[model samples]
Target: MAGLLDIAPLTEKVRVGGATVEVSGVSAGGIVAMIARFPEFRMLMTGKDVDVASLVSMGGDAVAAIIAAGVGFPGDEAQEAAAARLPLEAQADILAAIIKVTLPNGIGPFLEKLTALLAVKGGAEALAKVRATKSH
Candidate 1:
């Protein structure tokens, strides 16, 4: 059997582009509470139809990919190795670690608190302070 065909169905399953943003976003009502501090992350998560459900579902697949890519014979070892010194196994493990927290319950409280914070403070002031202030 061909390997490309193996991934073809999995590819069709994911409507969104990738897992990082989507899954991370889902962990916070699909808004990416972690990204609230970063300007670029703010921009991406500030959208309306961020598709939290899709992200949560796709997260598992993404994490699996990360783990699979870590072994010596990485899934994309040849092409990825050429671009950078990322070992097949190591990079995958790293990616998996980053995505690990995007789980369901893990993000619920974070989303609620983030919403509360955003409601009171909003993004404008959050971006104001250059240094860590007494009150955020």
Candidate 2:
């Protein structure tokens, strides 16, 4: 998870099911949307001290890596079974943790589609910790 946060090696791969997927960079706008709602995204635009276009162009592989890391289980069957065995809340917790560790700012409001269940279960604290951590 920590490794996923490092955006340097743009070609890194993570195991997902039986095949390997490359973790590519994501647009900076995408990154902002990932951690916060559009209404609140201005913080990301200004707070990060980054060039909007450059940050957007920064890490295409990073997004893939974050998702791959979120679904950490290997093997298609195993990943499916793992997801099935856990309650949606549990899955969200796992997913949120993965995103939090993978992204410098933590999971964005855009991810409410995925982490809505997690937000109900102390998502604030989880996000706080992720925010506290420094990303490379």
Candidate 3:
């Protein structure tokens, strides 16, 4: 109960059968990001410029890519190799675009799978529109 990880802060607000139910939704959705697959940007990114600034100003793909990388999620060589295939500059922007598209209020899902998914999704101009809509 007392150690490096604790769910108390997360659960204190809601309950399952009681007030717990309220927190349950938040907990599952929230912790999924934590327990779900995520990777380190340091590992994922080369730290160069690839259109992230323009993308993040819109605040959507920035959120999406961060999600898709699955910082917490450990993937295989194929996964890392797959991520590496992204153009150095476009990596983060790719995620930003995904987050921009699907997210209504939050970016967790977007951040969770932004990059990897985009590589599969494929498209530059289309991605831009997704992220830009957040501002409008």
Candidate 4:
């Protein structure tokens, strides 16, 4: 019954601050907890443009919290503190790794296509024209 629906959590091994750590894909519960603790996280789920500046302003504490939650250690102050101590590059890598596991389809292809499209001359204008045509 329930066991039939139980799938193992997706996990990845990542190097963080000279240590190899296993990071699990964020679960439904983890998403809920993140939304509860950090309302800004909801923007990502909703496909809204997240304010990067605002998130960065939240500083290391927020980054630590995100890492802890993604690592399946939500509400663990000790774990969060440890994550905060890691170098910024390591933190970014861990976050990227977590996102990779969490998103089944992965965003790399989409981003690459988007970047290519945006690189084209008048791409924004063409997109706007298409949108305008659709609205008419």
Alpha-carbon shift of residue 119 in model 3 (angstroms) = 37
Top-down TM-score ranking? 4, 2, 1, 3
- Among all candidates shown, the one with the greatest lDDT: 4
Per residue, candidate 1 scores C-alpha lDDT tens digits across 21-104 of 212212232233234322333432333222333233334433233333322223453533431443334343344443343332
Instruction: Report the Cα lDDT for candidate 3.
Output: 0.37
Residue 99: error of model 1 in Å? 3.1
Clashing pairs in 4: none
For each candidate, what TM-score against the reference? Answer: 0.27, 0.27, 0.26, 0.65
Q: At residue 58, what lDDT does model 3 achieve?
A: 34
lDDT by residue for model 3 (10-54), tens:
211212122211111122343344224332222222222323463
**Which candidate model has the greater TM-score, 3 or 4?**
4
How many clashes in each structure?
5, 14, 31, 0
Worst 10 residues of 4 by lDDT: 46-55
Question: Quick one: RMSD of model 1?
Answer: 14.5
> Residue-wise lDDT of candidate 4 within 6-84, one digit each (tens)?
9777899898656798889677688778777875565454433333344445578777887898788987999999989
lDDT of each: 0.35, 0.41, 0.37, 0.69
For every candidate structure, what is the RMSD over all alpha carbons to the true structure, in angstroms?
14.5, 16.2, 17.0, 9.8
State the local distance difference test value for candidate 4: 0.69
